[model samples]
Target: MSNNRQPDWDPRSPAVFDDQIAAYDRMRGRCPVARSDYLHWSVFRHADVLRVLEDHGTFSNVVSRHPSVPNGMDPPEHTAYRALIEPYFAPERVRAFQPVCRGVAADLVGQLPAGGGVELMGGFARDFALRIQCAFMGWPAELHEPLRQWTHRNQEATLSGDRAATAAVALEFDGFVRGLLDARRKAGNAAPDDVTTRLLRERIGDRPLRDEEIVSIVRNWTVGELGTIAASVGILAHYLAAHPDLQRRIREDPSLLPAAIDEILRIHAPLIANRRMTTRAVEIGGRRLEAGARISLIWASANRDEAVFGDPDEFRLDRDSAHNLLYGAGIHVCPGAELARLELRVVMEELLARTRAFALMPDKPPVRATYPAGGFTSLALWVERCS
Candidate 1:
């Protein structure tokens, strides 16, 4: 996997995840808009990422005619679906789920080794986030394990760059989500407050949304929420543990945890790239992009661009310009972003409030994902609780 990275960089090194500052620093000007047969033309500069996202007409989100629910659709259709689902992830709704998210975090963290030694990723990161998503979306708890397994499998298949496998997994996941939607409809009227109930009853494009569309939105969301949120917890814990002073400051004042989490996500976005298709001939970085060219907006690289963010490699919790492209830009930005933020904040508060410190084992290094999914694979930590 490391060898697949640009010849100049080595992400395979265990130390890189622990210390990505140097690698990202070296990548800025060298290959800002690199083209690869596997991932296509990856835009690393902040300006390029923003331009690709902002110019929907030139670089359409509807890439390869993929069935990505509304994510693949441009304005109008995209706008309609966004209207239907955006409210569900609004600030107030995120706030409403805080208690549930907090409870889930506290329960999981409490079950960890109080004195020390816990695999932060699998121990609590993956399971807890999956459970929380289940409760929030009115999905059954029994499906958590199955859903987690499916998320990992689908990610691997998609990253393999295999069209057949990606399609197979997509169909399987869509079926699972569709079953849930069907059950909701048969049971008649949502219990008044569930997201599925609302989605089932909503209308899009002059008519009610199809069951498959609802399934696609819910499936994409759950898969993303579970993996990214879980991986983020590991990243947050690792960074905090490595910097005791920052940990101490955050422990002393919980208010800083949210800002700290945002900074952490901005600095280490779990996602790698999102694809866009060029509509016509265009120029980028003095290169001509012909019509129908597939481009990848590399958020991981763009988030670290020095032009928009001074001293971009440094992880400053109080960075004045943290408008990182981690959550993407423009209209197609993640609708569940606020929900993700709230979940991270609550989890960080719980972990920090309970554990005094966490340390990576001297000899054992953390695991990381391959090209497409870029984040921690395993985060083993030694927990120290406050007396």
Candidate 2:
């Protein structure tokens, strides 16, 4: 109800969206925990955000009325869905997916233009994410175009803040997943053994998961797996292009890619923020929030908080990993974190191995994505594809 108050900041302003990282950095220093009519309460500090995360009892994840599988659930209810989904990203499963992931990466990097300026985001990064997601889920290539279009609609609806539009796009996605489920069911014994099929037989207590639950889980993964991976690919490539020395070093010794990837993503987070609601009155960062308060945990800011990372721009591998909220912390920490790591590492390794060098196109600067998204939407890079 207090959303009627004066706004602290316009999150969708050109100043913030044009360069999200810089704008967020300023917000962190000026007001670590801010009240915005747009975001309700935006928590910018690392410690403050971590506090909300660790204490889920005080900060609920059910910020929206729409159900979001385990992502929007807490404790007892969340516990069951979380346990059910985590095994999907277990070590064995991730290891098994490595070769498939590598093939997708190599194919994408292989498509880069020869020593010419190419728009990295649409040309390579997004394609890589789309291909990898389909491969990981055992979906057909025909679904790629539809998923791409759906992702765009989802992002637009989310940023527009139109609940009706958001719900409409969500139903469109459910239809896509339901179609896949129906095919697998009709195929019966001939169904291709993949994640979707596996999910069909999964049980919550004594009952098989309903179609709605299955669709919700798949939607959450698509939101997590597809968009973030695409953003991360662009961020990683842009960072490497900007810093040739580090890129050269990574190419020389690919062993450093994992740590380097984490550090780079720490510098520029792919996922902007996550939502939470105050279940009880709590004071955070000199501001008291009443119960039912809507909160936005700005990962884009927290990961780069100067207090934790000491000179957020400096790239160093020696820093403590525990403090990096790149994948977040606490009970609701990303269950698919291992899968993300495996995918990124495989992609980077293949990219470095395939390319001699890549540099930003001086003439065409990168175009930053607006709110509800992170990283560049268009990145022109002069890619020197290796022989």
Candidate 3:
């Protein structure tokens, strides 16, 4: 594989880091299928991305050498693990957790400042995500701070592209999960009957899942839940604050929250992109890619493609949901979509129900999160609580 193609874009550039959504939008128009030094090949258009996703044989999910549970697997192997993981997010399971999720949301919303500016990301969004995830996994409150810090470190290591740093952070996370597993094992039958403990008992092919497998599965779930859920919260709140009319409509009609939440997330994606590797030479978006080429599905851009959606930023409740790739499509669609939906819907319901209105703080604007992260890193909003 001789390399002679000039880079189409620099994914690590300061401009991309400043506003990833806008940058991706530009890329989608300029070069739907792009090549870069860091990301290798990036897919931007909705149709092109859907093509890659549908044809998993050509564009494989086994992009990483490291194990990623089901996310990094393909075919029969992916199918088995997906079956094992799907039950955890079954409709019944997600419905059962609604109360717990609502309780966490209500508590966080109630803690918002009475009449002044509030940094939604720190003061409310992050805490809500942390609490709900810990509760779902039967983890102790003590793990909240550590997990939050771990998420930050993981993102930093990923952005730096320092393999050693990324590996070190991953090991730190594994250590945390391993300790929990050991404690649960020691407790025997007395162990809490939760997702984590249940995973320890899950069997694959007539034998119990190995410790490493369990860690990987749990790590995948934790990362998705913590990062996307938190980013989604901030994005939702910011959208509502910026669009007071839609906010008021949702506040008046709580039934619209679910659809509205999905639409808002589509406009500004939480999880930026997913990786894939081309198994064979293929042509996509008029660009020829050789075998073993790395692919990055830019969800942030694909969901907002003008070809699919007339105006990427337009807020429409009646739009078709199937076209939205917020949870993705095809074999590798998000397993926890129902759980994520329930979490987002519950939190927004509580917030809107509790407050008359919340508006963006003019003096303190939000700082958009860098690449590998979506939504605001810090969002300041002025709240007007219900009297």
Candidate 4:
């Protein structure tokens, strides 16, 4: 609930959107907790972000008027839905998904040009996300392009801060999920026993789950899959392309990849920030605020905080990973983190194994993606196929 008080900074300004990580870095040092009209209040420091993460009771996740399924719930209700979805990402499930995940990665990697200029973001990284996510959900290949367009529209609406448009886009997505659910229901016992089908059968209480509830659950999964996975791939690919020697070294010893990917993403986060709302009056970073205060925990800044990492850009495989806020933390920590990590590791392995080398094109620099998306909008890399 920000008011007519002088705002600290503009989050949607050209300066901030140009390079969100650097802008967040500047904010972390200047004002650890600053108020802005766009984001209300943004928590920039690692310590403050950690505090908010640990104290979920004080900083509620019910920040939006629109329901965000489990992500927008607090405690008991969140606890139930959270527990329901946790098994889908269990270690056994992830292990089961690896071969399928690897197949998707390899297919996408094979589509990369041989020793030529290619825009990795457009049809490659983005397509991989769409295809892999659909495959995971037991969705049809036909949904890939539609989902891509849907994701683009969703990001645009969010960036514009258009609640109506965002909700409209959300409804459109719900339609997509509902259509699939209808097909499953019509098929009944013949329906494919996939994640979506299982969700349809799940019960939240004594009553069976409703369509809206299932839609919300699928929405969360799809958004996490389509947006962050695409961004993560582009970021990892760009990082490797920009640092050929490290790329060569990782290629030489593939075992370094899992830790290396985590460290690199810690330095340049694929997901920028997430929202929270205060339930009661609280003082954070020397700033006092009342109830229903809007807060944004900037993961991009917290992970790169100099106090935590000392040298934010110093890539290392040996650093204690407990501090990395890449998948968030606490009760709200992303359920999909393990899947994300496995997906990233598999994709990078395929990308590196398939190419002899990948370097940033001399004349073509990558265009940085804006607010709702991290990584590049377009990344041109000269990729040499393995001989």
Stretch of 10 with least lDDT, candidate 2: 1-10
In candidate 1, clashing pairs total 1
Q: What number of clashing residue pairs does each candidate have, in the order they appear?
A: 1, 0, 0, 0
Q: Worst 10-residue stretch by lDDT in candidate 3?
A: 1-10
User: How large an RMSD does model 3 have?
Assistant: 1.7
lDDT of 1 by residue, 229-334 (tens): 8878888888887788888888899998877887877777777678999999888865567898888777777887778777664777667543777678799888
Computed on alpha carbons, the lDDT of every model, listed in order, comes to: 0.77, 0.90, 0.91, 0.89
Rank list by lDDT: 3, 2, 4, 1
Q: Please give each candidate's TM-score.
A: 0.91, 0.97, 0.97, 0.97
**Candidate 1 TM-score, true structure as reference:** 0.91
For candidate 4, the 10 contiguous residues with the lowest summed lDDT are 1-10
In the range 1-387, model 3's lDDT, one tens digit per residue, is 123298889988999988899999999999888889888889999999999999999999998888999999999899999999999999999999999998999888888877778889988988888899999999999999999899889888987889999999999999999999999999999999988999999999899999999999988888878888999999999999999999988887899998999999999999899999999999888888889989999999999999999999999999899999999999999988989999999999999998878999888989998777899899999998775
lDDT of 3 at 97: 95
lDDT of 1 at 130: 88
Model 2: per-residue lDDT, tens digit, 1-387?
233356778888888877889999999998888888788899999999999999999999987777889899999999999999999998999999998998888888888886888998888888888889899899999999999999888988987899999989999999999999999999998999999999999999999999999999999998778889999999999999999999998898888888898999999989999999999888889888999999999999999998888899999977788898989899899998988999999988988888888899889999988877888889999988887
Estimate the overall C-alpha local distance difference test score of candidate 4: 0.89
Error of 4 at 272 (Å): 0.5
CA deviation > 4 Å runs, candidate 4: 1-4
Q: Which runs in model 1 stand beyond 4 Å of their true positions?
A: 1-25, 189-193
Model 2 CA lDDT for position 351: 82
